[model samples]
Target: MLTLTATPVLDVEPAIHGEGPTWDAARRELVWVDIDAGQVRRATVSPAGVVAEVGIHPGGGTVGFVVPSSDGGWLLGADGGFTHLSADGAATVLLALEGEGPAAGTRMNDGAVDPAGRVLGGTMALDETPGAGSLYRVDLDGSVHVVLRDLTISNGIEWTADGRTVYLADSGAAEIRAHDYDIATGEFGGSRVFLDLSSDDGPPDGLTMDDEDHVWVALWGAGQVRRYSPAGELVAVVRVGAANTSSCAFAGPGLDHLVISTSTQGLDEAARAAQPDAGRLFVVRPGVTGRPAGVYRGPVDALHRAE
Candidate 1:
């Protein structure tokens, strides 16, 4: 068992709904989102680090996740669209989901790049209505395809190290579903419950897989992050300073450190006072390496087209 410590890396006023913590190894930085704030934030990490807030943006609308791109930038999931947000802070739309009509919620939510370098993101209804959500795959050719539907609060997505299995968490469902993944064809099969939290654990929020194939999940409203073996056995629990812990990732120069993102959204004055670091970013050296973040290899360059 590894001892966990919560170090406040970045202190911000408040994040309404923070999620999607990704490590950009090349730049030694950590990137995340504040959904209700409609912003994406980056913080630089150093050996004797004092986490500095590097950048922030309107994020088009309720940005949920941002991943490094093959072209040396980022792919940002915004309100019903995938956009290109460069390291220098310029933003451009790459794909739009306007055709989804009334079913279309406010914006996209949690997302991650598959081993094949394609972007896989899920959407949620702004109104928090049940079944008003969908998961999508954005191909390199700028095509967006709905891969799953009837989801409420689509969140916490990751793939196994071998790229043969996909783990998706539906917070509302209180279940983490696994699917046999095909990297060559980008298809998912053999869907079933890998871990069910409705009976014992809290709602699953964000997730990350370690080098040993263990799944680490953040439990929203439970104030903890749990590690589960590949076969769905609970291994460890890393407590957080807040109940609204949203997402987590392994970052730092060596990808051995775990960073968690929490939220203060919907918390009243007394509740906020109880958890003063609710929206702050926390880090822990878990003594385990994590898989590098997959890059967004989609049509991000099209954002730079000449007028």
Candidate 2:
């Protein structure tokens, strides 16, 4: 098994729910979101020391995810719509899902861009109920297509380097599932169980792929991140002092450093005091390089034709 040693990097005031870890290699920074706090946080690291709180999203409309785009900006998933948020804090809605319909409680949750630059994300019901969620694929043309359905707390999505396999984590079910992917056609098939989290270890939240194509998953409530080979073998475990680890990403200039985000939500005063590092950012050198983040291709126009 792989041994892990984590070091606290940044301690934020109080992030109720911290998730969506993304790295911007060009800027040498890491960006993430505080879901309940309605803020996006950024940390810039240099050869000398770490500078924390480089940026923030003050308007705070339940921002769920943020990713660097090919256009030198970010694609943000917020309540009611998906939009582009520039470094200066300007927002533009690309697609809105707030129309009067069954998708009312649905808001974008976890998402990741495919190797071809297409954005694939999933939605979850506000009430966190089962069968009230759906997965969507957003193309460069600003169109959204529902690709899958029946999910709760949709989280942690990544694609294999070859683009032939897609991995998705359903936190509510404590399970990670994989799908056979068709890069050229933008289709997915062969859904099967990829990994299941033990109740004692908490549930799987967000995950990232390493150079070897193995998956490293953040275990919420378990206070640890576990690495698993592509074949689903447990390879390593990195322990954190916080029980509510939210998500993780490989950052640093070389993409060799693993940055993890944790949460302070649902903890009492005693628990919070016990885990002072809760809701803080942690980093460590994991000796593995991460695939560069995929760019958001927006929405595809041919989605309607596919139906």
Candidate 1 on 179-241: residue-level lDDT in tens? 999898777888999999997657999999999999999998988888899999887888888
**Residue ranges of candidate 1 with Cα displaced over 4 Å:** 1-3, 10-14, 48-50, 99-104, 301-307
Q: Could you say which candidate leads in TM-score?
A: 1
User: How much lDDT does each candidate structure score?
Assistant: 0.81, 0.78
Predictions: Cα RMSD each: 3.2, 2.8
TM, every model: 0.93, 0.91
Write down the TM-score for model 1: 0.93
Total clashes for model 2: 8
Candidate 2, 169-212: lDDT as tens digits? 98878899999998886688999999977564798989999989
For candidate 1, what's the RMSD?
3.2
